[model samples]
Target: MGLKLSGNKGQQSHRLVIFAAIIVLMTLLILYGSNNVNDAVYAPFHVATNYAIKATDLKKWSGKDGYVPFHGNKTMNLQCHNCALVTSSSHVLGTRAGKEIDSTECVIRMNDAPTLGYETDVGNKTSLRVIAHSSVFRVVRRPNEYLQRPDSNPVIIFWGPPNKIGKEAKGTLYRLIQRISMTYSNLSCFSITANKMRKFDSLFHRETGRDRQKSHSWLSTGWFTMVIAIEICDNIKVYGMVPPNHCGKSKPGSKKMPYHYYKPRGPEECVTYLQNEGGRRGNHHRFITEKQVFSRWAKQYNITFTHPNW
Candidate 1:
């Protein structure tokens, strides 16, 4: 089934039928298939987020340059039938979608959103985490929470402007992250090269028909996550990203949720989002504009949205 069996009774029955059909297909394949066999793919295996890397692949990045480990070693192997890209938006609150998000083959989270206290809403399992360079400090601030992943190996990809991530440049965040990777041997970290960053800028230009540099628009972390998802996964389900007009809709006196579920009092989600949309800051992320692009992507590819279901 494209989605999980968390709907009404009739929907459950329909999903049961689909389940039975899939079983039959698998059974027949096992009985009569050739020596070469392939993994069964569900309908949602279209796009995925979060690059899943393991500590075992760290000989120092030798292959692909898109995502080389913190040691600069290897490109992570991505295999997922369905992926869930969980956001930090407060819209995820009270949804109780933890079970559904965990049901996917891979769960990818952004930055350092914790699942410890909010396990009822956000799942505990994480296959990969895509991080923003500016948010690196937050993850390292609490080593006990983020880096000490004994139960699972989650790959982390850090993205930012070239000057900020370059070795010779003044990007102390990347240097700090490199130190953290060495300190925590169990953690596997990856970094997108400057070339890849330019490619993403090209992609943005292609999609929006505007030069990113001229626009003075800094790409959002969500944007990077989406690009990574499209490259690796066959399907993707995005959570907590509000639609483009969600803030503009005339819903009188609606409670404005916080920008991030983890930060309840920091900044209201829609207000900051509106500022991003208006391009108020010199290098601000175009949150609403990014959603518009995401909407187009959902139509063009196997992408879906939840938590206010776009």
Candidate 2:
């Protein structure tokens, strides 16, 4: 009887060891599955951001001409007028308040002046680097006609608003857009305004309606501009940009520096949405945050992000 009992006890011990082994294997399988699921979930966001940066690469778009294609093959054109040019210019000389006699230095343009043109050569054969008035520029076009990406033509960056505030600048912006449009029939124009931006908004007063100073006062139309640029371009080069003083303060006579250009009225309300999540749901307009995300995404997708500050 004692021998039989001992034999049974040994068998029970063997079964217990097998059961524990099964549990350990199951636990390991669960851990591996959970990790794979997490990776799968994050894969798309990584891919999208990577693809966006790759879309902005010049090498992928470069042709026989020295010109670089704007935004991969996708044209995400933004229009701006008198957005303000904080460029490097010789400082005005006056012997005042210092022993240093009239030393030349960089001077800031505090007022809205003439609009600088981005000259496009005839037949879309020639290329020129765009120089402008305000560091943060604006572009205007019909609703949804924000940018144009052509196969055979040079990519053009646009800046200027449609209103009479800066007519010549507006004209210059239109000229640039038309030049690109003339060459590329299917240029994608992405209008960045809060209110309706119909074609000929700048040419005809037909598109204007309500001012955004009242409702939804925390959104920056520029956010739309950036989104379009990021989404379209394979490689993006940002130059002459002012830190996000979105009230259009960079421009002359901009009262109260309206923080949100998308709202119905200016300074009517100070909402968190104005400062964060204005254009893209996940985007905040902080300079460092934008720079970091853009850089990482660009690098991952082999796109270069260049700032003119250097």
C-alpha displacement of 53 in model 1, angstroms? 33
How many residue pairs clash (N, CA or C atoms closer than 3 angstroms) in each of the candidate models, in the order given? 13, 48
Score each candidate by Cα lDDT: 0.76, 0.31
Clash tally for model 2: 48
Q: Where does candidate 1 stray beyond 4 Å? A: 1-64, 167-171
RMSD of 2: 18.4
Top-lDDT structure, candidate number = 1
Candidate 1 shows a clash count of 13
Writing each residue's lDDT as its tens digit, candidate 1 over 1-310 gives 5345455767879999999999999988877654233223211111123422122111221234577566655457866779998999998989899999888889999998998888778888888889888888898888877888787777778887768765446367767878887887777788887877887787776666656777667888898888787666778999888898888883888897999998988899888877765553376677777787788778555889998897
Q: Looking at model 2, which ten-residue stretch has the lowest summed lDDT?
A: 118-127
Residue-wise lDDT of candidate 2 within 1-310, one digit each (tens)? 9999999999999999999999999999999999898676423111122222223332332222222232224433332211211211111111121211111121112111111221110011111113222322342332122223232222233333434213233454444544544555544322222132322122111111212222112222232233334334343433233332332233554433222223224442223323442323343333322333344444544333222232
